[model samples]
Target: MELNYEGFYRFVRDELNVDLNAYKEKQLKRRIATVMKSSGALTLEDYSELIASDEVIRNKFLDYITINVTEFYRNKDIFTDFEFILRDYLNRQFKNIKIWSAACSIGAEPYSLAMILDKNNIKTNEKIIATDIDDNILKKAKDGVFKDFEIKNLDKKDLDKYFIEKENKYYIKDNIKGMVSFKKHDLVLDKYQKGFHAIICRNVIIYLKSETKDEIYKKFNESLVKGGILFTGATEAIYNPKEFGFKKISTFIYEKI
Candidate 1:
């Protein structure tokens, strides 16, 4: 039986309340194939039946849709711009330097930001809340583990200062690890963290539709205090900001007004 991928998507939406239609088809299909291959379903209908009827399959679908690739200091330009905003944040905010790493897969981005704060002596008064929809990734993130290659882009001093090299891998050290708190959060259903100093939600939105991107951006804007910075990945940005109460801070940066 040939599975109707279109029908499967509709079932996922109406039954699960998860919008598979929001994702880019090419990417979505690629991920779906991984599950299908694992299930060894020769026909599309068989795969659709498996996906629609099994709760485990439903969770797997969410995992595939939300999991994404990341590296430390991904896109140097974004970090460079973010650093300037961090300095500004330090100057103005004395307490509750709350930051939310929405969709902080495996914790690289949040750990990287933690290293930056520790280096600048801003970690003392600051707090970072890292969230992901997937519990599997969140557990790894909470452990603060990383392979050596994950930190390859770092300079020698930074690598030495922030990471402990052991057993052929590197782990973010206590200084940075203590700076973050990880939790399970779904961007679609959860309320925003209020009055944060910054929100680094990079790369994850490319999987979402423009409407979702705008919806999340609006939440981010409302979550931030005046002058709070919102960082996005290169080639990923909110399609509009007036609706979100944010102003373009730079090419890939925005600040709440």
Candidate 2:
């Protein structure tokens, strides 16, 4: 039997509440096919049936589809630029700040922001809201435990300052962990929260379709307050900042005008 891509997409939408259309079809279909093959399903229909009946299979399917490759301070240079921008913005603006780490996988990005804040001595009452579509990843983020490789970007000083090494794993200190709150959020389907001083949504949008990416950018703009910054991944720079009511301040950083 032939694999019905449309049928599988519909099944995922109705069953999982994830819109496959938001992703580029070629890449998304290839990923879905790979998952189906790995699961030993002969066709999309078979795979769909298997996922529908098996909770574990469904969860795996969801995990496979969402791109979750992230690390603390993934791109060091961009983060350095972000620190300077954030400090300058904070000094010029309000003392208290609210930041949203959209599509934050495993809490690294938000926790990184928290560490930067702590290092700079920025006192804020609000906890950083870090959100992802995966609940399991969110749970891991809340746990604040990471492997040695995940902390590779940090220098010795930072490592000692922010993490407690126990056996083979590194645990983020309470001060950093206390700065963030993790929540499960679907960027494609859910409503975005508003009035954030900054929104760091990096790398995640590259997997999305152009239209969906534009919609998300517009929503990010709406979510930010005036003069608020939108920090994206190095490769995911906005071609037209004015279209989204954003002014390009630096590479991968935009301020809402």
Q: Pick the candidate with the highest lDDT.
A: 2
Off by over 4 Å in 2: 1-3
- Best-performing candidate as measured by TM-score: 2
| Ten residues in sequence with the least summed lDDT for candidate 1 | 87-96
lDDT of model 1, residue 209? 70
Q: lDDT tens digits, residues 163-226, model 1?
A: 8888988888887888888998878767776878788988888887777777778888889888
Give the alpha carbon lDDT tens digit for every residue of 22-99 in model 2: 999889888988888888988888888899899888878888898878888999988999999888775469778899
